[model samples]
Target: MAETRPVWVIYDDGSTGHMEIPEGDGDPALAKPGRLVTEAEYTARLEEIRAARAARHEAEETARLEAARADYDALIAGGFPEATARRLSGYQGTQAPAA
Candidate 1:
């Protein structure tokens, strides 16, 4: 059986969590060093970190969608066909039949 030890994590945003260090001493690239904390504190901090990440991801996706819409509109205004515009804008909808 491999041995595991509890360790604290300090996230990039300054949030902290307690996690078990996997056997083989953990991957330095994947783990950040921090002072150890109680299990309860770790759980609470982990929730906060997850929530913050979700919010950030949502914001990024919204921005990307908005930009694609703008690009599609611009392509249409520039005389490109609707199907071509959508394709160039990275849209995944069914293409209209060629007239």
Candidate 2:
């Protein structure tokens, strides 16, 4: 039977988790009092967190762009200067589209 012992884990975000310690690392009882995690576990957790953060950032950016587009559309419809409209729309301060 494979021997397993509890191990302490401190996550990158200052959190903690515990897992079975590998055999031959002295002993679980003798292990240091610090965070511990398997390579696979750590990688999976980090990737999951990164993916979530990326998704949130993308959503926020999309919302911001949409708001900017709406404001630009309103300005263009209201007869604002073409250069000003394009600038507000994040364009290169070029001429606006012909009405």
List the RMSD of every prediction in angstroms: 6.7, 7.5
TM-score, structure 2 vs. true? 0.56
| lDDT value, residue 99 of candidate 1 | 38
**Lowest-sum lDDT 10-residue window in model 2:** 27-36
Best by TM-score: 1
Which one is best on lDDT? Answer: 1
lDDT of 2 at 75: 78
The deviation in Å at residue 51 for candidate 1 is: 0.6
* Regions of model 1 farther than 4 Å from truth: 1-33, 92-99
lDDT of 1: 0.71
**Per-model TM against the reference:** 0.63, 0.56
**What would the per-residue lDDT of candidate 2 be over residues 1-99, giving only the tens digit for each residue?**
778776555555644466675676663442345556676766676677788889999999888876766777777888888678767777443344545
Please identify model 2 stretches exceeding 4 Å from their true place.
1-35, 89-99
